[model samples]
Target: MKKLINNPNHVVEEMIDGYAKAHPQHVRVLSENSRSIVTARETADGKVGVLIGGGSGHEPAFMGYVGPGMADGVAVGNIFASPPPDPILEATKAIDKGAGVIYVYGNYAGDLMNFGMAAELAELEADIQVGKVIVTDDVASAPKEEKEKRRGIAGEFFVTKVAGAASEKGYSLEDVVRVANKANDQTRTMGVGLSPCSLPQTGKPSFELEENEMEIGLGHHGEPGIEKGDLQPADQVADRLVHDILADMPLGEGEKVAVLVNGLGSTTKMELYIVFRRVEQILNEKGIQIHRSFVGDYSTSLEMGGCSVTLIKLDDELTEFVDAPADCPMYVQR
Candidate 1:
């Protein structure tokens, strides 16, 4: 596979170094744990510390969200792999002030196991209180009755944002988790993959697709999607994704919502906006008011060519948190 990376084995380390250097004002790498990034901004002693973690390759995800008004610390793992308990615990320790710490991450097996162990380890060794909120918002991953079984996709962004905002508001650890869980429960996401992503180590695509074929509802790790079919227009794809999500969590007329149209990887901003245009059209036709919309590569899967659309049903509380100021390198809001 053609990639502009150094040794595959060192890609994650090099990336961390580069990111730390580039965004010194926002985050810093823990000297003892390179995979653990702590926000540069100081938080109040009584404020809950927000900690997020997950596998790498989804840049600006677990790490990029670390900063003021967002994640206080992030434990980054290898590409598509869970961070070990050591780094996870290190991240938790780095952010903990005295109140408590909350772990926010996608609902994946490896992530759950590692982060869960880290939480236990922290309590046993450091006497730190910890809580967790798993994001499971991919509507296409499971049936409506089985949302807890669905995988977390771009919807993780909304959950993380709400968690950070809640913590920044000085909410207690339990309240922060409660806010994040509410966001995750209201959020729904669906994606379409036009091409597969290649791993640096293997130098091979995770999956294959024909020039004219696409996989709808594909997971970030090349997990099975709803179906593969001939590629269609961007509007058609957007329609299907929006339809499924809305059906899963229907929005009332005149209801406020937040929209995120995220690129998986190689998908261009031009293409993402095209998808967003259709998304906006659909939401308008449905009388669902979009309070805010974000379009870009917020989350990615190496160089996969695809995009996911996320909608979070917004209430006054959620809107307030979502609008809270944030100053992360990759994601900043005022």
Candidate 2:
């Protein structure tokens, strides 16, 4: 119930204001639409536009990814709520530069509906060609056979990274969409939740867990997970998450991957690194090469206490795009 704010209803507005002010060099709120945030840098002509968005609570996502070599714009929504189609269309129009625009977002019902509506409006009103890629990377959300039904989680970072890079490289809209889908397909993520987060308006915990209990495969919005049990050591938790990911998409001994150990919100960096230590050991034992590793709060749910591990099986194209230079508020790659 403890939150720092003047009014719950105004949290989203205030947040956008503060974010734009803090990172004016990287992003700015659209003059016509308050909910749309676009890159302050000049976009190249004929380069495909990368527009990403979802709910507001998952910071550094949706908004933080908009920059020089990342997403060109974002349609920001309220906390855990899909943005209306107006802002989406606004962002789409702002980013489009004749090469067309592509929408990259998590596989959530609200986002699908809102963004879909925005795409239709863009085509009908502005004659802008728009593409879409829905990230479905949470292996725990569904069986491998039903991957399309899986929910997107921390692995969204990989999808955005690849999509933005492709767009920056002047890929056509079709090609950008193709590479984005490839990234989502190759990525897998699983999370364990130790505590719950309360919404600003509700001021009540979204879910409950016993002091010594934990839930594996929990979604960012306090969705039910696959199993609940007594808390285990960091290594055990890492093993379980990695095991499920590998099972969903088996990797060969010589295959390469990009590892992202993401904190949900309140999880400490020390704990995350400890978990990563075990993850590295496990991968090394299997002779899998880790092309790169990122550990931090890439995507988060308010103040939830948990973390997710994301691995994107990489090939040459993916490696190049992932390693490309990107500068943004929440993430930067040199």
Q: lDDT: which candidate is best?
A: 2
Per-residue lDDT for 192 in model 2?
97
Model 1 vs. true fold: TM:
0.98
Q: What is the TM-score of each candidate against the true structure?
A: 0.98, 0.99
**Shift in Å, residue 3, candidate 2:** 1.6
Lowest summed-lDDT stretch of 10 residues in model 2? 60-69
C-alpha lDDT values of all predictions = 0.91, 0.93
Inter-residue clash pairs, candidate 1: none
Per-residue lDDT for 1-334 in model 2, tens only? 6888989999999999999999999999999999999999889899998999989998877788889778999999999988889999999999999999999888899999999999999999999999999999998899999999999888889998998998888889999999999999899999999999999998999799999999999998999999999999999999999999999899889999999999988999999999999999999999999999999999999999999999999999999999999999878999
* True-structure Cα RMSD, model 2: 0.7
Q: Once superposed on the true structure, which residue ranges of model 2 sit more than 4 Å away at CA?
A: none
